[model samples]
Target: MAGKRGGTAAKERLSRDVIVASALALADAEGLDALTIRRLATDHGVTPMALYWHFKDKDLLLDGVVERVLEGVEIPSYPAGSQPEWHVRLLDCFAALLNALNEHREVADLVHRRFLGSTAGLDIAEFAFAALQEGGFGRTERAEIGVQALHNLVVLVTMEPGERALRDSEEEVARRIREKKVVLQSLAPERYPNIIDCAESLVDKPADEGRYRGLGLDILIEGIRARAARQLAEPAEKAS
Candidate 1:
């Protein structure tokens, strides 16, 4: 019995939690793509076979990492604080997610790969459902539109390429706008009257981060409300 007990202890020397935790740390330090079972085994000073006991392959290991990353995401109760009164709450939630993603950029790359139907995602889905209902959307159709809006924002921000690489930096933002303004101004007046007319608006001065975020939030939300109102006014058959 003592020998059997010792054998069991040796068998359980490492755990899935330990492997996942180590993998998360490695991904945080290096990028997610850099995380390999062999590298993990080397990090833990264990043989590759030991890791296989925990994760069958890299994809499984990545699933574990995604779980770990989301475990840290705090989805607040719908009425937790001075939010939920309006669209700001939703924008704040998205901004918070972006901030979190920026802090742990390795997870940012993996954000699109997350299960959209997971428990965490369900909270977002449910949150939008409730918000739309409160905003006068009925229990039935509002939930669907709410989901569409949420997904639009998520996919838009997530799929937008090159936050780190190009077309998105302090200097680059200014440079691109300047270049665009120059190109628009050089166009023939009659050939591109619209671009020439709106050149100043197109290259408007950049707002600070807070104001910029607020403006974007305001535009999207107000635009959604306008669309909803327009749909409500149309004939039932014509609305679609």
Candidate 2:
């Protein structure tokens, strides 16, 4: 009987976590689009039906991969009355998330697409919300800012340059930036004054790009701090 049903027997050595790990490796090497069940089954020396025993559907399989990747992310403990401000703590969390996602470029898209449903995603949301609440933001404001924070994370990982983009030599990067600057500066200043005025910055490698996670998070935290202060002071203006 065991020999008759060879398909299941072939997958006897595979576990759910093993399958998810294999899928994650495949995605890391060749993007998420290449992570199909049939491909994974072949990789694992099993049949598609064997994978079904572990993950009922494709979505479930991807969910497992997401969870596995997220498990590597480190969420720091921000105790009450901590020395660092809440916004700082939030930045730390965001930095950790960016670094974790940076390691797996293929999963960055998946994280952005389905983050709200993942356990690590909710953990990050809860942490940020607590920080916002502590910062004196109202419930509605917290929700709005939370959405923005999540969006920023998605943009940071997906849009920012990855290992592949940075694989070029330093000379190549500088040459590319110089060409971009000249092109931007060559545009008719009469028609586009702003572009001409900021041409140097527009294509400045160090100033305009690179380390997007830090740059973007700095801007976001500053904006949130300013908004939180204004929101806190609104009641005082009304009373006075």
Question: Which residue pairs show collisions in model 1?
Answer: none
The candidate maximizing TM-score is 2
Tens-place lDDT digits, model 1, residues 22-116: 88888777767678999987876667777887788988888777666555666555555556564555555555554555455565556545635
Q: How many residue pairs clash in each candidate?
A: 0, 0
Q: Write the per-residue lDDT of candidate 2 for residues 111-133, one digit (tens) a residue.
A: 75576677887887788788888
Worst 10 residues of 2 by lDDT: 159-168
Worst 10 residues of 1 by lDDT: 158-167
In model 2, what lDDT does residue 183 have?
A: 89
Candidate 1: where is the Cα deviation over 4 Å? 1-14, 78-83, 86-88, 136-219, 235-240
lDDT score for residue 83 of model 1: 65
TM-score of each: 0.59, 0.80
lDDT for each candidate structure: 0.64, 0.78
